[model samples]
Target chain A: MSSVAIDLAAVNKSYRGKVVVNGVTFTVAAGECFGLLGPNGAGKSTIVRMILGMVPPDAGKITVLGKQVPAHARLARAGVGVVPQFDNLENEFTVRENLLVFGRYFSMSAREIEAVIPSLLEFARLGSKADARVAELSGGMKRRLVLARALINDPQLLVMDEPTTGLDPHARHLIWERLRSLLARGKTILLTTHFMEEAERLCDRLCVLEEGRKIAEGEPHTLINEQIGCDVMEIYGGNPHESIELIRPYAQRIEQSGETIFCYAPDLDQVRKQLRGRAGLRLLERPANLEDVFLRLTGREIEI
Target chain B: MMRMTYGAAMPANARNWLAVWRRNYLAWRKVALASLLGNLADPMTNLLGLGFGLGLIVGRVNGTSYIDFLVGGMVATSAMTSASFETIYATFARMHTQRTWEAMLCTQLTLGDILLGEVAWAASKALLAGTGITIVAAGLGYAAWPSMLYALPAIALTGFVFASLAMVIVSLAPSYDYFVFYQTLVLTPMVFLCGAVFPITQLPAAFQLVAALLPLEHSIELIRPAMLGRPVGSVGTHIGALCIYAVVPFLLSVALLLRRLMR
Candidate 1:
């Protein structure tokens, strides 16, 4: 078995005249959780598709596990699991049948699949709904079913595309907990997510992409520390820009969005001193996080 | 010298397609009774209405009673309709609406496997529909038993041919409504001109030429004689034509779908 689960070298892809992924390269070590984080149309889907061998990258090389992709993709996929971006459960089947049919696609016998169904249902918290039709399940239940279905083959590397895009806080936290358990069992995970918190909580190391190019790559806290510093000061309401000059000397980076001004620094002593008795301006100081890092790197504008 | 190479994984595995076929078979089994009855209802109506009602007026036009003459055509029509409808409607839902094929693609199965399994399932349904009508005709004393058993191969071949052709239509169809054109332009015409209810010889010379080209016409050519306990002529030619219809369209559907969806 190869220690490297996935490796990409100078991969390039384009559709018609427009470039989608431009010379992006990354490697995922065995049992390491790697994330591909980018805004919409940042070529995240194209890259993922290339890795899965669904589409041939126009240029560059890709290897998943030990097989060169789009050539030995079937052999490679025989050991990989994928949770797609949306809930596409087999609607006609019951929860157990859904898992059975998916396992069949992997060439598993019914007896073999039946052997694993109970444990997987327990893992998904869908043990009670074993015979329930897919439509009878809630959105969270359906999402969990898709997750459980992906594990039918007991894959070595799990690729998840936005695993928790729409879910209640409780369901989201449960899925996160399950993912943590998967990691604890030494399963490698490659995730693409729009949620900064999801990427922060799950990914051991991640790459941030912007307009088909990699802009930043590192650990969540390390990137936050290197770019935005230890503390972030927010000034809400009032003329927050007027205080920018006051706090500029102490702040390493300052940005203004709408009626709020953000100040990042090692500490808020200078901001606290300068903004003292600033009247209507409400100032809040907290530890900087991954969202702060993401916004600073990708910009606030919604990429269409 | 320039290097020329392309890499596209088209792993052709029989086991993979069998899995797809098994999935569809399992699902279809839930509604199998209703579906078979629905297919029967159409042909049964035509047989009783045209065979008995019209046969009373026509008497024996072709050396046999019109009711007995119509049994073979009805069997062929049932096979074609069942296979075509299953491919157009059920396969369409799996590919476009439910995104079932998309889900299967994420697994170890390839596009080829998915399509082959889908068409094979449709063909199986066709086989059942055709065989059902034959058994019904035999029970009603309209067809001979030992001779009717010979029609099974012909009926099975018609299933493959129609299922393959319908899948080609499905691969090219944009939405549900696009199927109306295939129904109107291709299938409905075949019914009237392919000797299902009437002999193609009664038509103008040009239409006879057209009817002779249809796969359903060849189907009836093989099945009618067998059901009537008569000699089947040009057996190799009819079988060859049906084989072309089955193999060509199936391969075409596979290629067309690869171009359409895999991109």
Candidate 2:
């Protein structure tokens, strides 16, 4: 048996003469929580689709649970669960019926599906809404139900694509706690999100993609330290060029955006001291995190 | 270049297709009464209104009561309507609006599994509508009871023909509005020219030739004889044509949907 849950080697995909996922490579180990963090259209969803065998890569090899993709995709899918970015729940069925019907797609018997409905509902905190129609549930409730539906087969690997994209913080935290429990149960997870904090909280290791290429890969803190240093100071409400020139010597690197300047340094004391007496300059200092690392590596340019 | 293989595009397991069928069945079971009533209303209305209202004027063509002639044609039309509505509107809703096909694709179910299952479900719904109308016709003394039973398989075949052809339209459909072209251009024309409302002999010679090539015309030819207990004419040709409609479009639908969804 292979220790790798998913393996992609030199994978490439293009659509209509335009490259989407270009020569990407990564491996998700068994029982490890791996995340793909990138902005929209960074090919995160495309990569997820390829792994699910929904689309074939133009070049390279992909294996999930030791089975070659698009060849053994059905077999691989039988062992994998997916929570999509969109709400694709069966609108005609009740919450419980949704779970039951989806379970049938995996060839599970009625009794087998019924046996897990209670526990899965509890896992999603949807026990009270079990008989409610999907349309009757709130967005949070629907998302929870989708999560429960993904686990109907008790899959060995769970794939989530922007799982909490539209949820409120409370709902997001609820899902995050459930995901943590799944990781504790030793389930391998492959997650994709633009939410860096979500990745930092749940992923054992993560890779950042920009324009179909992986720009950085490591543990959250390690990538932050390597790419962004220990602290980030933002100075707004001052001449951007003047701020950059003053903070340049003390900082490891400086970036100037419209109306503000960001300075990355080992420590913020010197930069703060240099800018203290300057009037009309508003300064804020924070510990460096994944978002800083993401912005620095992928750049501040807005992807159209 | 690696040629795209149908082996990867189409599902190999029969059980997976059946599972898709079962999923639709379970969902439909909740609104079973409303669904049946909705499917039955149009055909029943046409049979009563046109059979009596229009029958008063064109009374007893071809040695049978006008109502009797209309009953068999209505059975064929009922199957066509039910199957077309299911595959075109209902299947399109699932594919685009509800995103049900995408959800099923995430499971072990292939796009081919969903397609075949949808075709089967549409056919089954058509069988239901056709069977109900046949029973009503028999109750009114227009059709032979036992002979009408033989029309069940023929109704199923009619359902398959329309359902498969409608799915080909669905594969190309971008939205619900796109279905209007098919409904008006294809379905409406077939309803009028396929001997469902009037005898094909009434049409011009050129139109008669065209009508003979339609699936519904073949359906009516087989069904009319079976319902009236008359010996079927050109049994080989009628059934053979209907089978071609069912099968050829089914393959085309699979190929079209593969291009649409698998890309």
Candidate 3:
């Protein structure tokens, strides 16, 4: 119980009688990074909001850092940090003023916030832009500033929803590095991302949700292994239906989407060899990744 | 060491509404010059154009010059527009466009605390608008010095009344477009009907009954006498009416916001 940072057991939520989250359960051990991966309207935001104590679940219980949620939400939120999906920076204030103002939300006085501003700016690599208006900063700088602002209280757990969604590769890598440092210092992170590469890289364990139900939960590697086997042959730019028909016999599982057919097989080399001389086809064989597991579980078809 | 993490746990916040107010204050500071001028523009035009243009046709009203009679009404309505505009435009931006309030909710603050902060901030802005006109009135010698200061509490309470009322509309508003109905159908009509321009007695009997029910009428009643250095009347009833406007809509707004946002 002491080691568990967040526990949502049989949690259920509904909106206007529409079941948004139905009997979902997960636990994040302290000092571990947990990822919640789902497509749009799969109830990811609903679950995140409930955990932050914004909405009460229709059924089940949620405890965060040992405090009951939506009841002790304030006490729980006081110890938690959040990096929202959007940067949501205050454009009206200077970069430094943004951090200064946020401290007061935690009941910290201006003077206390002043003492922390310099160090927080340094953490964000934004010391030079301290007095600059938020509108003046680049997208990357604003994101970093938001990341630094979330740490004003030095929370025990950090809840980040799509923290690096719109950043360029250089910026996203920088954010990833900052997150790695936070994790190294023993902060438990609850992450939700559509980036399978990010989940593969950063998440120690993750859960995939389909239509508000927990479809699969395990370590990324284990999920890839169990759901998608060892390798996948991605055949694209030909005819996916015909490519799928040709590879269906040897592939463990085949999912065709758009112009690409993902053939997940225990031995995809056989499929690769068989397609060696096929005309008008593009094929690449690689180790099955988290994207393969995610696609296999949630399916490649568009969901509303 | 410059290690700036303040991880020390503390008691839950009780007065962090001030924090929310301070944020609005900081945000407003950037556009302070333009906004103050905007608030001044409405009453200034009415004071010059209507006070002179319309005042000539209608001579002394309530035993005073036409423009002087309008002074008290202008002060009351300045607060009305200030509180209403602030609540509808600025507060709505924070809630919808900027998502500032949404970010605030992610912190230790509750919906009630944020609402209080918005109310207090709107009231403060209304107070500024009301005071600007009061100073101009005193400068023009239409209002008594220091006595006009007595109207300030009434000004603030008017702010509370209208700002909270606007918040109720804000809680119900689906988008920026919905605010126009309240602005035109509700607020713009209140100006003409609430005795902000002419006396309610000048209004028909049916209109007077409505003017009696609205908070602005009671406000102008209290504030006009105070601004003119006249002996005020109906003190208890007026204050009670204003208090009802301030408290009920405030409570209703918080409840409605909890329903709209928390869901």
Best by TM-score: 2
Q: Which tens-of-lDDT digit does each residue in A116-202 have in candidate 1?
A: 999999999999999999989998899899999989999999988888888898889999999999999999999998777888899
- Displacement of residue A283 (Cα, Å) in model 2 is 2.5
In order of the candidates, what TM-score does chain B achieve? 0.95, 0.96, 0.93
- lDDT (10s digit) by residue, model 3, range A13-70: 8888788999999999998899988777888888899898777788898999999887
Compared with the true structure, model 1 gives a TM-score of 0.95
lDDT of 3 by residue, B130-184 (tens): 9998888788887877778889999999999999999999999999999999989
Error of 2 at A45 (Å): 0.6
Instruction: Name the weakest run of 10 consecutive residues (lDDT summed) in model 1 chain A.
Output: A295-304
Instruction: Supply the global lDDT for candidate 1.
Output: 0.86
The sequence of per-residue lDDT tens digits that candidate 2 reaches over residues B163-214 is 9999999988888888889889998899889988888899999999999999
DockQ, candidate no. 3: 0.37
- Give me the displacement of residue B166 in model 2, in angstroms: 0.3
Every model's DockQ: 0.52, 0.68, 0.37
Residue A201: error of model 3 in Å? Answer: 0.7
Off by over 4 Å in 1: A276-280, A301-304, B1-11
**Which residue pairs show backbone clashes in model 1?**
none
Task: List native contact recovery per candidate, as a fraction of 1.
Answer: 0.61, 0.67, 0.58
TM-score of 2: 0.96
lDDT of 3 at B120: 90
Error of 3 at B163 (Å): 0.1
TM-score of chain A of each: 0.95, 0.96, 0.95
Cα deviation of A298, candidate 3, in Å:
3.7
